[model samples]
Target: MARRKRRKTRVVITGISGRLGQLLTRRLHRLEDHEIIGIDRRFFRRRPKDVEHLRIDIRRKACEDLFRTKKIDVIYHLGLMHDPRRGSQEHHTWNILGTQRVFDYARRHGVPKVVLLSSTDVYGPQDDNPAFISEDAPLLGAQRFSQIRDLISVDMMAQSYFWKAPEIETVVLRPVHILGGVDNAMSNYLRLQRPPVIFGFDPMMQVIHEEDMVSAIHAAATPGLRGIYNVTGPDALPLRRLVGLAGKKPLEMPHVLAPTIARQAWMMRLLDAPAAELEYLRFAVTVDGSRAKQLLRLNPQYSAADSARAALRLGAWDAPSDAANQAEDSKGATAA
Candidate 1:
């Protein structure tokens, strides 16, 4: 008698309705032997034909039912909250506690693989920061910015799980400035008609196109790929140049007073992220992706600058004319 063929791998992904989540779900759903199971509090325009989407929070006890029913082999933890307001209880509950709950059950259920999505902002922007930061760098992103404290804590949790459970394959991906046609904090900031920039500071930054981010997730799901990986686009661009490339004017301002001004804008709901995120414009937190390229074989198809340009166009910001933008930039004025 012939040997039986192996069963397909059933993979669960949280935040399935999110733009990035949907992208990854669609890609993995098309795979020949991969089953897609999604967990989200909401749904998008449409889901894949065979995907099983459950509208439940990750922390809910009902999650175990999915594992028991599907015998899930791997899970993609991509659910993250991006509210910039300080002391958001929901951010902590969803981003941190939710992760705790997911890992807790996965280990209990004997799930063997987990892939986590983290942001490069964990390194924090500092003048002393090396031009090319690696995984070994200290994650001080939560120092002044308490908003991202949950991200750092969750990152630590993932790292802890990697060591504590030697049998499991835990892969953590920290990508810089994830952007595409989607509108997120970084993307929305970049799409502004005249985004603010720290005076006399032009920090270098990297951005990974959303497509590449999804590709990295796909690679992380492979059998043997497990570890911390830095995924980024091709090149780094200066703050002013980046905005110009996006057909937007740069509003120069003092880094000292920027926080207060930004907070006001945030309260008025003019800007998506709080003042803490503006540190990216003051210092470079550029990451080196050579390890991910060699280990996960992530071939980022889109360049950072090109992604920024395309994202700007897609966001449909009513950017002022080139002459007007130049005039405003020359005055070093402020934007409301």
Candidate 2:
């Protein structure tokens, strides 16, 4: 008698059009046994032919049908909004209500595993923060950066699922500042020809390569893994050195003037982030990845220098094509 072949794992990835999502899709696509289905409001350009891409909002009724019909093995909720440009109400609804819907669907459809990619920024940078923050640290990210509060809510909501749905494995990976060809605050900041740094302040920072972050998620997706874990890359380093590694000259601004300047620049659409975000430059928010290392078996594969170079490389943002323009225009029509 011949041995039986295992069935394919049906995985659904939200935000599959984003850079990090795209990277994860490619990685999982290589494994022929994983059937990939993407749920996003954005169009996935040049996606793998085998991967099914659905341009729909997670909060929509249609999205629920995907769960009701497909026997999904894992759900990767990466659709949380991080763009500060969006209105507060839009941001809150997308991150908070959207998360609630995902969890509800998993519970309703009996999905076994759900992985949420949260950021370590939820811990917030503080003047008196410990040298190595743990996953148990309080989430004060919204204290100064109000925009991050929605994200904190999402992370907390995911945590609630552990108790609310005990049978389902809920793994939340709070990775440090991820660098590489991604459209995040850190990546955008590094893309500046002259990055800004606060005068008289050089806080230590930790960053993970986009690939390493995807790797962490892969490790967390394994069977029977649950709970929150802090994922990090190489050891922490001073902000100035990290900036230098990105091949950009730091434009030092007095702490007093920096906030006002950032606010004004943000208002004029010159800066991507708000003034409160400067706290990361003045205070360290490094996290301990020992839990992930021991449990998820996650190991950072890219060096800080390698991550820096990848962030600065040509076309890091990958300019969108015409289809993307259409997607953007109609994305608001749906519940995101």
Task: Show pairs that collide, candidate 1.
Answer: none
Off by over 4 Å in 1: 1-6, 85-87, 313-336
Write one digit per residue (lDDT tens) for candidate 1, span 124-243: 998899888999888999887878888999999999987788777999999988877666777887888788999989998788877778888888888877889888876888878878
Global lDDT scores for all candidate models: 0.81, 0.89
- Residues 158-252 of candidate 2 have per-residue lDDT tens digits of 99999999988999999998898888998889999899999999999899988779878888899999999999888899999999999899999
Error of 1 at 245 (Å): 1.9
Give the best candidate by lDDT: 2
